[model samples]
Target: EPQGKIDTGAEYEAPRNEIEQKLVQIWEDVLDIDNIGINDDFFSLGGDSIKSIQVISRAKAKGYYFEVKDIFNNSNIKALSKCIKKNALTISQDEVVGEVELTPIQKWFFERNFEEKQHWNQSVMLFSKDGFEKEAFEKAFEAIIIHHDALRMVYKNENGEIHQINRGTSEKLYDLNVYEGLSEKEITEKCDEIQGSINLEEGPLVKLSLFKTHKGDHLLIAIHHLVIDGVSWRILFEDLSKAYEMAKDGEDIILQDKTTSFKEWAVEQKKYADSYNMRKQLEYWSYIDKFDVRKLPKDKEVAVARIKDLRSVGFNLTKEETEKLLKHVNKAYNTEIEDVLLTALGLTISKWTGEKNILVNLESHGREEIVKNVDITRTIGWFTSQYPIVLSSSNEELGMMIKNTKDSLRRIPNKGIGYGIIKYLSKDKMEFKLKPEICFNYLGQF
Candidate 1:
C-alpha cells in the first residue's frame, strides 16, 4: 500500500466512532474482507469502482449518504465517515416508471445502427451447487425487475427517431425457462437461443434460463446491452444473491432504497450537455480530433471483421508480480494501474511501429460527477463513454514515458465524458470525426 496505509495482514487500528464502525462493517461486507481497519486503503483491499458503489449503496440503505467521489477522496473508514452526512435532497421512494431519455452512450449506440441490434447483449452464466427453488427464484427476479426500473425499458422507432420508455411494474419483467437433464451441447444451444431472443422494441429485455443437472444447476442471464453495463451487472448480481437468499428463507425481500433513477440521470445529462462548462470542452475535443497519428501497419487486411474473425491470447502474471503491480509499483510513480499499463503499451507500440504519437479509443465507466447534486453511483443503466485520446510516446527514458503517459491521461477533462456530450447532445453541429484502430479499456479486477 501507500506510506502509512494499513496492510491487511498487519496490525491495525479499530474504528473510533459509530459512523466509523458502520463504515468498517460496510467495507468488510462489500470488500469480502474480515476486520478491516479504520486506516486501511480500500483499493489495497481489492475494493474497486464496483465495490465502491456497493459500499455507497449499502451505506445509503443504512441511512448514511455520501457521494462516490467522497470515497476516492477519503479512502479509509475514519476519513470517509467524516465526509458522510444525511442525504440533503429528497430522493423519490416511488417506483421509477415513465419515458426515459437516452444517455450519450445510448445515443452513440443508436448512431452505429449495427446489423442485428437485438443480439447486442451482455450475459452471464452462474452455477449453484445446491440449485435454486423455482418459485423463490421467480420472486427474487421479480423483485429485482421492479427495483431496477431500467430492466423494464423498451424502445420504439417513432418517425425514424428511437424512443425509450420505462414499462410499469405490472408488465412482464423477464423470460424464464427450466431445463432438466440437458447435455453440455444442449445447454450451449439453449444459451445461444436465449441470447438471440432479446427484443428491443417489444417488452422483456432480460432473459433467464435454469438448467438442472446431476451435479448442480446453471442459471443463464442475458440482458440487452442498451439497459445494462459492467457496473449494472455487479449491482444486479448482488441484489439477486441477497433477494434469492431472503426468498429461499421465506422472508420478505426488501432491497435498498433506489439511488437517483436512471430516468433522472438521462434528463440531467441532457441539461449538463447544454451547460457552459460542457461547451468549454469543445476546444479540447476538437484538438483531439485534429491530432495526426498514423495507423499501425497490419499483417493482413479484411474488408470487414466479424465476431468470428476475432482471436484472443491470454497470459498471467505471478502472484508476487501482481502484488507489486497492484500495490507497490504505484507508490514509486504516484500513478494508478491504468497509467503503468498504458505507458508500457505506448512504449511497445512506439518501438514496433516507429510511431511517437499513438492514438487510442479510450473507454471509461462514465459515472462522473459532471452535474452538481446528481448521483448515479447505485443506479443501474448503461453509462459507458468512448472517446479518442493521443498518447505522446516521444520520450525514450522509462521514467519520462510513464510520467508523460500519466499526464496525457490526466489531462482528459472529466475522463473524456465531454467528448460524447458535445458529439451527441450539443446543439451546434460540428463535424468532429476521429476513429482509432485500437480501443483500450482497463476493466479493473473483478
Candidate 2:
C-alpha cells in the first residue's frame, strides 16, 4: 500500500468454516459494514482501539481470546482470520463487555451547577473560492458537527449534580440553526465583531459564516476557546481536513479515536487538586498579589477592545534572522519555544512598567498527564492551566535568567496546586475593588 492505501483488500485465508464465519459476522457487526472481505483493514475503515476492544470482548464472551493488539497488528479481516486458526470460538452472545470507564475528572465536578443554555459564545465566517458554494459549504459544515462528540456535548443532571453528557453526533445537526444569505464581507465583519464578546461555552463552541469572494476564495470555521483550548485546534483542523478530503473522495468516515474524554480529565484534576501537595502548592499564590505592577506606556487600550473590524497582528522573523537567534537561544541555553516566548513577554511587560519587580502570569497545557493519546489538539477539554512565575531582573544578565528557568519550573510543585490555590485565593470578594475586573488575561495563539 502506498502511504495509507488499502491495497490488500482481499488477502485472507479462513482456517475453519465456523470460526471464520463467526469472525466475519463479529467484524461486520462492530464495524457496521455489509461486505466481508478478509484483506480489508479495520483502521482504514474507521475502526479504533475502543471498537477493537468491543469486538474482543464480544469474542471472549463466545470463548475466544483475541487480544486488542492482535486486532491492531492484523488490521485486515483476512489476517485476523488466519491468526484465529485452530480456535473455533463459541458464541453465548449474552454478556456485554468493553464498557466505558467513568473518568476521575467527571466524578469531581459532577456535583457542580452547570449551565444549560449557551455556556460560551462563538462565531465563524465561511470563505470559499466559489461564491455560489455557500450552500455546499453549509452541507460540509454539518459534517464537522457529526464528527466531534465534544461539540454536541451538553450539561446534564443525573442525580441533583451536574455533568457533561456526550450527545453522540448522529443527525439533529442538519437542523443546526444556520442564518443564511450573507455576503462574504458582511460575514467577515460579523465574526470579527463578535470574536471579542464570545466567552464560549465550557466545551467546544462553534460558529460558521460564508465569505464568498467576487472571484471566490474564503475561510470557514469559528469556535470558542473555553473547551477547545490551544492544542485542540490543531487536532480539530487536521481531522477536519482529512475528513473533508475523504468525503470528497467518497469514502466512509469511521472516526474512532476518543479513548479519553474531558469528564475524565476534569475528575482527575479535582482529585489531584485535593491532594496534600496541592494544598502546599496553594500557599505559593495565596495573596501573592501577582498583578501589582506599574502603568502602561501607550495608555490607549481597553481591558479588551470591542471593535467592529478584527485585525490580525504578529511579528514575523526571516529565516536568517530566526536561525541566528535560534542558534544563540539553542547553543547558549538549550531553551524551548515557550521559555523564549515567555521570557520575551516578561521583558516586554517589564519594559512597559519600567520596573524589575515583575510578576507575570504564565500558562501551560495542564492536560499533559491527564489522558493517554489525548491529542490535546483535537478533543474539547479545559486543558490549559495558569502558572505565575516571577522573573526578577535587577540587572540585565538575560542569559543567566534563561538558563535558570528549567530549574525554577522544576522546583515548583505539580501545576494542580499552583493554579488551584491562585483561583481559590483570588476568589476573595474582600479583595475586589472593581466590578468588571482589571485582571490581566492575554489569551494568545496556540
Candidate 3:
C-alpha cells in the first residue's frame, strides 16, 4: 500500500502509486480539467458534492466500488488507489434489473412532439483488461448483449398508452476497435463513424464508441453520457468491469442488476395518477405567478427556444480575503455557497424586473432516488425535474437576499422536472405551462 494515508477526514494530501494515474485520468475526463495532483481533493479542486456522487458511483467501471466515504477518506488519488483491491467488484451475474418496458419518464419524451430521429445521440464508456485482449473484449460484449436487454425502451402515446422504445430485436456488434494517439480532428471523424452505429427509433437507443490509449502498463478509458444517465452509466461500468474481470479468471460473472426492466416501471407508473403532486405543483405555481415582474427578462422574450448563452466566469480570493468573506457571510446568515449563488442571480433579476419577489424556474437532475438498492447504472431515461423558486430580494444587501432565497428553495421536493418529460407533459396544457419566464440551471453533470 502507498504509505501516504491521511485521515481523509483531516488534511488533504496526494496518493503515491501507479493507481493514482488512472484516478487522475478518470477525474480529469469527468471534471474536464487537467493537472490534478494525487493529493488534490475533488471538491477543493472544484468538484461539487453532486458531482462527487457521480464520480464515486462510477468507481465500478474501473473494477472498484467507492463508497461515498472512500473518496472523502482518501481525498487524494494515491490514497484512493491504496485502498482499491483488484477484482473488488468481480460478480457472477449482471448488476441490473430485468429489461422492462419504457419507464414513465421515457414515455413522456415521445409525447414532446419533437422531431423523431432513429439514432440516440448518447455517450458511452467501455472498459477491458489492461492487457488489451481484443478477443476477450469481444466475448465480454457479446455476453453483455445476451444477458441484458441492450435496446429496449417504451414511449407513451397521445392516448396515454405506452409502447416499446422500438419494435425490433437489438443488433449485434459488427465491429470493435480501440485506437490511440489520434489528433482532435481525427477523433471527430471517428465519432462520425461511431454515430452510424446508433438506431434511436429502431434497434439501439444510443451509440457506443471506444477509444483506448496504450499507457505501457494500463489503459485509459473514456465513456460518453448520451444513451445512459449518470446513474445508469455507473451500473454499466461496474457490471461490465465485473464481467471482464470474471472472464479473465474463467469464472461466470454474476450481476446485482434489477429484477424487472425499465419497461415494467413505465407500465406500472400509469396506474398511479400524475395529478396528485404535479397538479398541486401547478396550483401553487399559478397562485404564485398572479403578480408578474415589471417586465420579463430578455431570456424569455425570444419566440424560439434556444440555448441560453453560457458564459463561464471565474474569480479567486486571497486566503485572508476568502476567510473574511466566508466569516462575514456566515455571521450574517447560515447558508451554503450554493445558496449564495442562487441569491445573487435572484437579486440580479430583481434589479432588472423591479419585482422584489421574483419566481425563477430552476432545472435539477433526478437520476437516483428510485428503486432503492437497485443498480440503475445503464438504464437511461429523462431523469431531470423543474421547480419554481421565488427569489425575494431588495436593492440593498443583494447577497443577503440571495442567501435567504436559496434557504427557502432548499425546502421543496427536489425531484426536478427535467425538460425531456416535463416539456411533453405540459405540451397542450396551459396549467402545466411554465410559471417563471426566467430560468436557471446548475447542471452538475454538464
Each prediction's RMSD to truth: 2.7, 13.1, 9.1
Error of 3 at 145 (Å): 5.2
Compared with the true structure, the alpha-carbon lDDT of candidate 1 equals: 0.84
TM-score of 1: 0.93
> Which has the higher TM-score value, candidate number 1 or candidate number 3?
1
- What are the runs in model 3 whose C-alpha is more than 4 Å off? 1-108, 115-120, 124-132, 140-151, 154-162, 166-183, 211-227, 248-250, 274-282, 288-338, 348-359, 367-380, 396-399, 414-430, 435-439, 443-446
lDDT of 3 at 288: 49
Supply the TM-score for candidate 3.
0.58
State the displacement of the C-alpha of residue 105, model 3, in Å, after optimal TM-score superposition.
4.8
**Per-residue alpha-carbon lDDT of candidate 2 for residues 267-342, written as tens digits (9 for 90 to 100):** 4544544556555654555434444555445546665544334575678899676544433344346443445555
Best by TM-score: 1
Q: Estimate each model's TM-score.
A: 0.93, 0.56, 0.58
- Candidate 2's C-alpha runs over 4 A off are 1-147, 154-171, 174-184, 190-204, 286-314, 325-328, 370-378, 415-418, 421-446
Clash statistics: count for each candidate: 0, 24, 50
lDDT of every predicted structure (CA atoms) = 0.84, 0.49, 0.51
Q: Could you give candidate 3's per-residue lDDT for residues 72-175 as a string of tens digits? A: 56766766776775544322343333334543345445444444233334554334445456565555655654454433432324364544543233444224
lDDT of 2 at 148: 53
